[model samples]
Target: MCNSVVLGVDIGTSSTKAVALTLDGQILGIATRTHQVDRSHPGRVSMDGEIWWQEFVGLCTELSPHAPGGFAAIGASGMGPTLMLCDAAGRGVAPAALYGVDTRAVEQIRQLEDAFGAEEIYRTGDSYLSTQSVGPKFAWFRQHDPEAYAAARTFHMPASLLVHRLTGAYVLDHQAAGQCSPLYDAARHRWIAERCELVAPGITFPRLAWAGDRAGEVTRTAAAQVPGLRAGAPVTVGTIDAWAEAHSVGATEVGDLMLMYGTTMCLVATQDHRVRHPSMWGSPGLVPGRWTLAGGMGTSGAITAWVRDLLGGSSYDSLTCDAAASGPGARGLLMLPYFDGERTPILDPSARGTICGLTVRHTRGDLFRATLESVGYAVRHHLETFHEAGIVPRRAIAVGGGVRSALSAQLVSDITGLPQQLTRISIGASYGDAHLAAGLLADTPPLSDWNPVVRVIEPRPEPAYDELYRLYRQLYESTRDIQHALAARHSASAGEPLPDHRATATAPERSVTAPERSAPVSPAGPDTPRSPR
Candidate 1:
């Protein structure tokens, strides 16, 4: 069999995508499987952890035909840093708690902050404790479900889970480790033992590696499940989906920013040194020594989806056309795209979506356009935060499904007053995964050769957007109290108590139940296995 092709797969909030690509970045085949997250409880977002592996196997099987010659190496990425508990056999013990979208850890966040001084935590973690943090989520898991906590032998995010199943190497990338906050010390690039014990006692965290580092070879067992992958195929260490998406479009340079338009709108700016702020996330970059400053909106395409479904399931193409005709300012309508709370910049979980200046004259187009523009405003807010932190990204590369909408992509450029480069291949993280996999081989081609910039969307700023942007910021400040009240009311009716940090003190540290082990075995060595043809 030919050994020139590699495979990459990504598990996302709404779908799983697998792509097979030649070493030179020619996409041989792409397969996608759609799924939804569980939002059964208020302020919580989760998904059946088992479904991730299930879809991976299915997608690999379907895409195998295109890779006639077995895949030489494989790479994976996914939506994270999710909290998924696993047993000794690597099976998920419960539904995985998703990232910032899951706001069940507010109380835990306060408890941890009080226990460990907030400033100290931020100083070490390079990020502040928020819904985006995994430490608080671990605390919430231990507090809310002690049984599962005790039963869990290890914890994993989606990508790491796939790696464990594929190569029997339990590992987490440095980029993902930084997102654990408090639990990880970004400066040292290691887990904080005291913080880990306090939040998730006895949990065996995965060994840390960089995103493209080789974790191990695909095991014979994994080979049986995934077609086109031989038992000894190399597999790169996995990372979060957004970072992978950034790499896909060559946005990993120090002065580059990747704006992802997907279930959420994420902005990741590459930096040479650590850059931390109260309103943004600073984490280890895909490779060691490099760092990243990032921000995310809780909703983007999700809002558009909600609008489309609300308008009797109108097609996105039709809705986008209508929104384009609605013009800038969305016909005097303004929106706060905080449908599932927000992340980065204003870290407000209780924030709710609001559309002001709505009248009977407003049509579906107006509503859709306002929804799209709201995300643009949110992107602008993130850019402002970057400026506040003294980071001015020299280049902005756009990727993801939302970028497929000409109107949506254009609105973001116009509102943010930034030109966005579009990549030739837009398969998102899966393509990035394949690129990472290709890097494991010698004589790898440069990113420009794989996926060059195809077009540019330049800003067409308008006076109307400038005015609306000011009101957009003011609208949130003016309605914050009301939004909090509504969120509290909804939680109360749902029989969920919003934790009151005022009355609570520090959370007590817990003891470890599992026996301590020696240092983790590094995945690299001269004897490391290679793919067999």
Candidate 2:
């Protein structure tokens, strides 16, 4: 039992996290270290890949001693769509450019539209520049920083870079490559050179491998920082965080959706065929033969976190209580939750959040409730899109910080009317990576003996939530233009002669808005239709 531990590292957008688990999926210890996501200027977000690796090593050491023995396998996962550039030595020359929200690539979107009709691109590829991708970011770097592009020897995503640093091997996982979008043709299982050249001609990222496939072994170099991490630990290839989150919940069947309620809400569902919904996200996630229909909302738990800070800077209990005080529909006050830019439905990074229908009659509870409901509204939109694509979610498992609250889970259920399940660890994405890795190791122990969920959160659909959702759907159409005007004002303020990456996409005409004003509401109760605990 002492020799049965495994190591899992989850590289998030803003931090690197590590966890120690036994082969049966039980976590023994956990550790984390935040890495800065540099957004010094608008339209640009960057980070050093080395920063992630070093922090990961630190966190692994921090978590390892508790396990008492060395790990059986090493697993890793990371924030999606963070493209890293490297020299021949695998050192990051410039910082990594981040995902869809980074507007530096909007110009690249136009170039793509011009080179190949937008219709053709979307129909064939099932994706666009609306965030969650690295192609646009790559195009922006090549066009604006040709000097850096010329000097770059190889391209990588964060996971590939982690694998290389761990074992001095530069290779990619196929699931991690989904965001390469047009660069990879899912149907053909090969890179599409013509599609890549439509934007960045010379860029060739690492070759792809399946998640859980062994890339290389750890070495003495990695062991220096990661205490007790065996140099010969079987190193499994990595995956994206959300994919790992999906595995954490045991959401492995077709029609099962995994809803990750974290800083932003992410939904990934396994489906029989490729799903191309213009308003939703679809990608090639872990299961190679099966396709994944993904849906992301710009705001979920983040807006609630914002409200928590604003309202007397109190605890989540106070915030949830505030939300509970207000009845469903947030007393007619609704928020879009697009504060950072949106993904699903609109796919407009230029879009923003909004608070609508505020009145003197409204209290803190009403406002708080609306923010919570906004997540449900966005999730329902995602669900509807999947239904259209013929992928109805039989059940959804909740994984993330939001699952801590019973009310938040209920709101999702009441709004969507689907049963939800929570996990014991819900420990972000890395554990899932380790879980899969251990299951695939040559001398691996059975996962069932190691990891087991502590509890499950079941959605208790409330009738009042349905009425609130109705109004939530209509508020955006009513204030769409107003949101656009705000973005225009934002863009106009940018002084001329900024770095290419500093420029953002033109604000869309207010055809929509999410949370325009900060609001609050009760931690609504979880919906009924309970499952076995």
Model 1 residue 106 lDDT score: 87
User: How many Å off is the CA of 516 in candidate 1?
Assistant: 34
**lDDT, residue 54, candidate 2:** 81
Report the C-alpha lDDT of model 1 over 1-533, residue by residue, as the tens digit: 23488899999999999999888778888999999999979889999989999998898889888777668899999998899998878988889999988989988888888899877877787777878889888888788988887788888899998899999998889899899987887766777777777677777777778999999999998887678778888999989999999998889998999999999999999977777667677888998658888888888999989999999999999988899899999888999999988886788888889999999999999999999999999999999888877789899999999889998999999999999999898889999999899888866776877899999999995978888999999999899878888988988998997654221111111111211122322323121111111
Cα lDDT, all candidates: 0.85, 0.69
Say which candidate scores most in lDDT: 1
Output the worst ten-in-a-row residue range by lDDT, candidate 1: 503-512
Model 1: lDDT equals 0.85
lDDT by residue for model 2 (395-419), tens:
7788877888878888888788787
Error of 1 at 23 (Å): 0.7
Rate residue 470 of model 2 by lDDT.
72
